[model samples]
Each structure stands twice: as structure tokens, then as C-alpha cells.
Target: MTAAHRKIIHIDMDAFYASVEQLDFPELRNKPLAVGGSEIRGVISAASYEARKFGVRSAMSGKLAIKKCPELIFVKPRFDRYKEVSQQIRAIFLEYTDLVEPLSLDEAFLDVTINKKNLKSATNIAEEIRRKIFETTGLTASAGISVNKFLAKIASDYNKPNGQKTIRPEEIIPFLDALEIKRFFGVGKKTCEKMYHLGIFTGSDLRMKSIDFLEEHFGNSGLHFYQLARGISNSPVVPNRLPKSIGAERTFTENFTSIIPLQDKLKDVCEEVSIRLQKRNLSGKTLTLKIKYSDFTLQTKSTTLPYYISSYDLLLDTALDLLANSDLKTSVRLIGIQISNLNINQKKAEYVQLKFRF
Candidate 1:
């Protein structure tokens, strides 16, 4: 019901960070560039289209990336500049519709079914937004238009880098049927292998199987596969879907049994969470500590404070106390710290001096 007769558009910026770098430094345009540190232990945050030609990609180790392209230029990320551009893009989206769901700093979903511009064609809106992005930020964005969010998102990737794709309702079935199983939204490497072994290589093959059979083979995920194969997705385009919680987690190569080592890990997790909160301009009243034993069993403990907190020291202290009071019968392989009940629009007066137990 949520997907019926709806018009959704997904807009994704082309090589956002790298593109921004190129825009700021005109000499870098049309050249191989990556945004990240060039340290031995560093990884690429983003790569320019030129660098991508040599198989250089974001998240790859700097050493490996440089091996692929010796001419790759590394530039440190300037998040503040990216945020400013994101705000500008969001402003353009709000001019046409209030139903804008941002996926990240450089991607978003816009529901223009009943927009302020009274536009009938979602494709037209997508083009206008793409044009505006280029004009305002000097960056190109690709777009996908369809009846639902799932289809729209996938279609957006069909034509990369300044292109747009539209999947009409009538064409959805054939489009999906021809699509490889690996291209489905939730199908990863393992899932693809499983599907291949089960003789399901494409959407058409998946469509031939009964929901019961698929579910029995893939567990709950089979239901999603079954629906997707039929081009049936009813997910909504939710607006202003702020994160419920913010957290940082780490899994150790070696399990830890001692309280001292675990406490040190907690400090790192808490610091990461605090940094994320500050970047988002958020504060939270609840603190949660999570632990995963070497055997994969998970346990979590949480407490609420009387006032919002965003300080690194406070978060670290609270997380450490939570760890101290936790059930530590087994060695932990993974640990995390999270904060919930966030106030994205927090005021200075919201902070209070109150000591609460973890």
C-alpha cells in the first residue's frame, strides 16, 4: 500500500569527496585523486573518477591504492566543506518536496508524489535537481526514478556519474527478471553463492520458487527475496528519519579476559561515539555498553542520565563504569558503546550536573 502509485527519486553524487576536492583545486580536475591520508596504515575515504579507472576505490588501503596507480594524489578530507554542500543540496530538495530522506552527505531519496511544484513526472524533478546540484556545487549527481524506494535506489546505480534511470511500473517485472541475483538489494557474496547452488541465478529463477521453499532455504530473508523477485516492495519514503542511537564498536583479533584491557577498549569506543555525536551536533541521555563473548553470545547494559551528555570524558567514564558493573564471566571478543534518546536540536540549558549510576 505504501508503494502504490508513489513517485520516488534517489539522487547520488558522483565521487562526492573526491569531486569536492577537484572543485576546490581546479588543477586536480580530470586527474587521479583520492581523499584520505597517505600513511602506511591509512585508507582511502573516496577516489576521483579518474583514479577509479585504475581500480582505485574508497576504503582500500593507501598502500594498495598507490600500487594500482602510482600517480594517485592523496588529500585529507574536509568534512566541514562537504557538510556545507550537503546543506545546499537539501535546500534544493526542500524547494520541491518536504519528503526528503537523506541517505548520506551525498545521497538522498525524495518523494515528489504530491510536491510543492505540483509536478507530474518524477523524472523531470530528478533532472532539475541534478542540474541544480551542478550549478550550485559544481558536482554531478545521478538519479533514479521509480514507483518505490527499493526500485528507485537500484535504478539510480544503473547509470552512474551524471546520468539518470527510470523504471516504469510496467517495465519493473522484465527489468528485475533480467537482473542477476547478486544485484538484488540484500544479496551479498555468501547469499549469492547460496542462491547459485540452489539454481537461482536471476530474478526470474527466484520468481519461479514458492515463498515457502525460498523461506525454508534462506530463512526470513527469503521472504524479502520472494517479494523483490515479483517487483513488489511496499517500503515507504520516510522523512527526517533521525538515527535512534549512535555507537562505535570494535572486534578484537584476540579475545580479552582481563578487566583492565576491556576498560581500555571501552575508552576508545566511547571516544569514537563522542566524536560522532559532536559531528552530528547531538546529545543523548542514555548510555549503553555492549559486549560479545568469544563464543558469539552478546550482552548489553544501559542506563539513563537526568540530563543530556555529549562530552568525551563523561561518555568514557560512564562506559567504563558500565563495563565494571557488567557480567564478565567470559572473555569478550567485541565491545561497543552507544548513546540513545538523542537531542539533535539540543540547547545549552539542557546540560546539568548530576551523577547517575551505570
Candidate 2:
């Protein structure tokens, strides 16, 4: 790998859903909590640290989670409120550098090799970002600083939840050697079992395996494993954190006809759009309604509002108005609503200056 002076930090919030629940409900503090569907068929979306200690985890069935931690408190998700906090935390990251890449509501990668503050050490930059996040959001985030994406991502997960780890270039080999096989990125349950059968149990064990041997066993994804084993990650920090358009659609168990039936389906679409818009912290100026006919033909009509809109009522009203303007044409099979003309993405001037001369 070519030498680089770049600094990248990966930050992940600790159990975002469960943390939010604790923040709102004082009773849930230090208790076992899982966030997701509260129903029998629902799965846990997030589990608090206390819940995790008892083997309860996100994506586990709520029933199974309760079996593990009999005292588990299940909470429904509040995406709108989560989005509000996401925006606040994001605002803090931007204070250091504009080259931030959000992976999800609770995680992001920031390239601060060249930042607004002209910080000399990436470690200090990470500390400041951590401090600012806690100050603004009342939540703690874990940070990992490294020269490349692979090391940085792994480092971030090392300490976790209100902690930070910095892996210097000189320490890369020792860090990789010390990690367990399961700790490697892209290696999950099934893969770990497979690796065990092949006598690959840790980073040192993986490094001794041949690249062609790995590819032969795991196919294309094996190439990623080979690079990760050597602590080589060339992925660039993508700076485009903007929505292309605000839209939502769904497939029904059965098709319907007429305005009344169609309106029922439209509600689901509008709700989805509102959730997406809130998550992206965006508003729209135009609403478009899409209709699909029984014959598989599709049509869409849109209307532009005079002002920017983020309110659920305004977005829903515009979508319904657009639907009312269109005819069934062919016994509508599906309907959807979309909002468009999104705001600019993250103020483009925030990107760090690339290092090498072209």
C-alpha cells in the first residue's frame, strides 16, 4: 500500500435504540432493554449493554430475548425522535471536517486528514469529536482512528460504546495478530465455523493461508478477507450523504381498485416517505403519485407545492391531491406517493482537499 498521511475515524453509537429508550424512560436505566417489535413475530432491533450481558441481542426474536433475560423491557421504535438526535450528532461531526460519511443513524466515517481546525494529531481530533458528541447529544459514541478503513473500522468496534481506540501504523501488525477469527470484519457465524474446520482461528492463522486457497473456498468475498487479514483497506470515505429523491412504495397481498381502496394503500406510502424524509432531515417541494394497473402498465402524476415541506400533514395532503387528479385508467393495482427536488447534499464545499497532485 502506498504511504498515506490521511486520518479516518469511525464512530458508532452504542445500542442506539435501547439508549434512546433509556434517555426517555428513567425506569429503564441500567435495566435490560431491547428495542424493536413488541409482538410475538417481532425481533429485537437494539439491546442495552445490560441486556447484551445476558445474551439478548438485536435481531433476536423478542420471545427468545425474553427467555434469555426474563426481565427484558421491550419498547417500540420512535424513528422521528431518533432522526432528530441523529441530526444533532451529525452537526457535531461537521464541526471537525465536512468529509463525514454516515453509514447509518448511529455510525459514520470521517476523513479529517485536512480539517477546518488544522489539527496536527488525529487522536486529538477524535477526542474533540467525542467530547462534542457527548456535549450536544447527551449520548456517548465510540471512535477508532487509523490510516485506512479496514483498521479504523475494526478499531472502532474494539473498545465500543463511549470508548475510543487509535491504531498507529506501527501497531497495525500487532493489532491484527491479536484479533480473533470472529472479530474480523465480514466473518460471521457460518463463516467462522467454516474457518474453524479449516484450522483458521485467528488473524495469525488467516495470514498463513494462501489467497488462491481462500478464493477457492469462499469465492469472491474471500478476496476481501485476504486484504483485511493484512490490515489493508483502500475504501475511500464517500462524502455524498444526500437523498436522491423522497419516495415510498409497497407490494400488497392483493390488488385493489377505485379511490377508496387506493387511498388506504396510499397511507402506507406516505408514512414511509415521512420516515425517510425525517431520517434524512430533508423537505420537499413536489409530490408525485404513482399508479400501477392490473395489466402491469404504470403512470405517475405530480404537483409542485409553493413552499418547502417536511410536515406529515403537508406531504400527505399533496400526495393525496396528486392522486385525486389522476384516473384509475385501468383498475389500479398499486399506488405510491413521492416527494422530490431534495435540498443540496451536505454543502459540497466541506470535502477535504485530496493530497496527491494529479
Q: What are the lDDT scores of the predictions, listed in order?
A: 0.89, 0.80
Q: For model 2, which pairs clash? A: none
Candidate 2 at residue 274, lDDT? 86
TM for every model, in the order presented, reads 0.79, 0.70
Q: Cα deviation in Å at residue 100, candidate 2? A: 0.6
lDDT of 1: 0.89
| Poorly placed runs, candidate 1 (over 4 Å) | 37-39, 248-272, 275-314, 321-337, 340-353, 356-358
Model 1 lDDT tens row, 76-115:
8999999999999999999999999998999999999999
Clashes of 1: 0
Enumerate residue pairs that collide in model 1: none
